[model samples]
Target: MNFLIASVSSEPSIDHAPFILSGVLLSLVVIYLASKIGGEISNRLGLPPVLGELLAGVIVGVSALKLLTFPESGSDGSDSVIMWLLQTTLGLPASEVSAVFTQVSDVVLLLSELGVIILLFEIGLESDLKQLLGVGAQAVVVAVIGVVLPFAAGTAGLIFLFGMAPIPAIFAGAALTATSIGITSRVLSELGKLTSKEGQIILGAAVTDDVLGIIVLAIVASLAKTGTVDLGNVIILIISAASFLVGALLLGQLVNKLYVSVATNLKTRGEIITPAFIFAFAMAYLGNAIHLEAILGSFTAGLILDESDERNELQKQVVPVADLLVPIFFVTVGAKTNIGVLNPLIPVNREGLIIAAFLIVVAIVGKVATGLGAFGQPGINRWAIGVGMIPRGEVGLVFAGIGSSSGVLSESLNAAIVIMVIITTFIAPPLLRVAFGISPDLESKELKTEVTKES
Candidate 1:
């Protein structure tokens, strides 16, 4: 016993300990494996892969099984997974472990942020600007109506009923405004109705809704950060956000032209991919520099690149990176969520659930109202169009993450958003099939085609 004690005490002290390289690597392994298994299970169960990834985080996270953890409150906490692993592995104390884990957490969070940027970029890449623009006046009507009603309903409900502060309420309202076209398109393709007129209008309007939603998010985020809402500030945020998108597109087009000239003499494995990444990162950096979300910059970069002559080649190159990083982002989001916050026994959680229920109703009604925007075309089942617009999917999650990160949303509120996303996503496919009077048989190729378009 004496010898053992002496040997243990002779090890490096906490303050002098070296970084635990193994801990960092092991964390990655755990996160990736957990995410992969969860995603696969979710897919098999007919749910969005993101939902599974999130659940994986919860399953492995501190609030439940404690498989994954960070300091409960901030970088200073000793209870996180990183701290525990480093403490045990390196024979360091909890406080000393934080120094190293802080770096690790920052890396993970940065990668997660990058994941969303890539997500937005992927959305932009799959889109056809000309097709989007040609969606007609009816799509515009539907898109505008769809965005407005939801924003108004969500904001009003939160303020009048929930009594949430105005800034946070605005964020909540903004979260309600997102529509995931990817899910809608896939369901339409499954029904073999992707090429139909109603499908076209829904697709067009959903895409338009995304643009409007992001703009709203930008405004809300700006207000949240500024801690006050003023007309001049609102106008400036709008102008800056709009200008960044417009300017990025214009500059990207010019750069792409120059890139074509330079590419003729270039030969490298990552020739196309490298430049694309630089453009995206540069834009993201610029957006954040200007007090806007980096997603806007990356999204505009995608729009610009999609118009390039070499777009197909670039798309192929970017997929591998996206596949690797996007899941990490989703998994991190899940890991951060504390499922315990949603317990109905908790008064805040109970209140949040009630608000969430109301938000869902508003979400449904506001989107359903868009079907009426297909006015003058009585042949279209307007209800089906509305159903198609219901799922918020990844976009809603992204918005919620932003709100939570910016401190505009409480944990209970975030849980409510998650519940809203789950309900909307789960209901969309079946409701769409019923509305279209189609069989439930889904085509693998159709799903694949939409996936291809998205990447």
Candidate 2:
């Protein structure tokens, strides 16, 4: 028996109805509580909450305390507590129990996928296209350089140095291409410099980076599914993704207008938010239909609806739902990780560690090189802007998750990416402080001052 599964099998069987109710409740309680504690600790340590959540899952996962159990592949294993709960207590047939477990896993996966959609949509809702455009040539230059250099460096390094296969290498390179501006934005905001030229450029560039990253994600996922790469197919995929965004945006405007009109007349609950979610979900489905990631469509939906007066209310309603679901996704990503691969004593594990170290170096350098893209604007702190873009955070994790799910990244490579994410996230706050010559205390004071001024 797989030790992990066997450990869970010691639980006593209960009545069918109670077993399911208690099992689900107990599992979620453990996941939520553990993730929460971990995130709190991480935040106290100046690390990203996602880091803590991931670690929490690892602590409770198969490779560790085995508090949570997933069914093992093939036979030669005892049923896990989860499996036994369904099969023995629930009196499900062996095959039905297996099917039920798969369904349970699928539900978790689907919820995580939905969390991604909601996250992208929230990002879109917060984005101001006019302001992004106003940042002008500097933003465009930074975004382009940021995307291209990191991508080229990551792909080339993986291919040449690590001898990674082309397809997986491309996925790795693409993972390096996105910058999670949220971390940088938060730090800049704390420093009372959100409106500074450097800050605006970083914000604009990060937005542009997000757009490009989603498109690249679509392209890579399509490539993975097709198992081949060709110019024609690539062009088609690009066009399909673009067209889906355009069409969804145009149609979504009409949908929003109709929703508003009907809601104003009907005076029903969830009028604005309900339609917003419907449109987002519909667009996400449409994106998947066209072989694009659902986030592209959901994000575009947010962009479109944001053009209306209903945006604030939509955001207000969505935030609560997002708060509840998003953490689940991050925790699941962590749970799926096999941290055993991080051990350097094992040969393959050591290789992964080396690759991770190299990727971290590449991730930092590539973004730093993007500071050069701020060329014409000599007054701006170009290097500071580069440092600002360095933390990949949630975006990198999302890409890694997608790559793993799609089979485009092996376990070793996934672990490397995760390590890169953790280190970058941990370091970026202090690095940004140093780059900008601001102390933590000064940053806090500045933030408080700004808040008072605003008030």
The 10-residue segment of model 2 with minimum total lDDT is 71-80
Per-residue lDDT of candidate 1, residues 1-455 (tens digit): 99889979886555432554555566677789888899899889877787778778767765565555554323353666656766677676655666766666666667778888998888788777777789998888999988999989999889998788888888888888889988899889988889877788899998888887887887788798998878998899999998887777668668779766665557977778777788888888888899988888787788888888888988887888888888777777667766677778888677767877888898888898898898777456788888889999888888887886777787777777877887888888889989888522234446888999999
Model 2 per-residue lDDT tens digits across residues 52-144: 987887776655755454442121113445566555566665644554555455665667778888888887787775665576898889998
Give the clash count for each candidate: 2, 0
Which structure among the candidates has the greatest lDDT?
1
Compute the lDDT of residue 397 as modeled in candidate 1: 85
lDDT of 2: 0.77
Off by over 4 Å in 2: 1-23, 69-100, 250-256, 438-455
Which residue pairs of candidate 1 clash?
Answer: 60-68, 69-81
Output the TM-score of candidate 2. Answer: 0.86
Residue pairs in collision within model 2? none
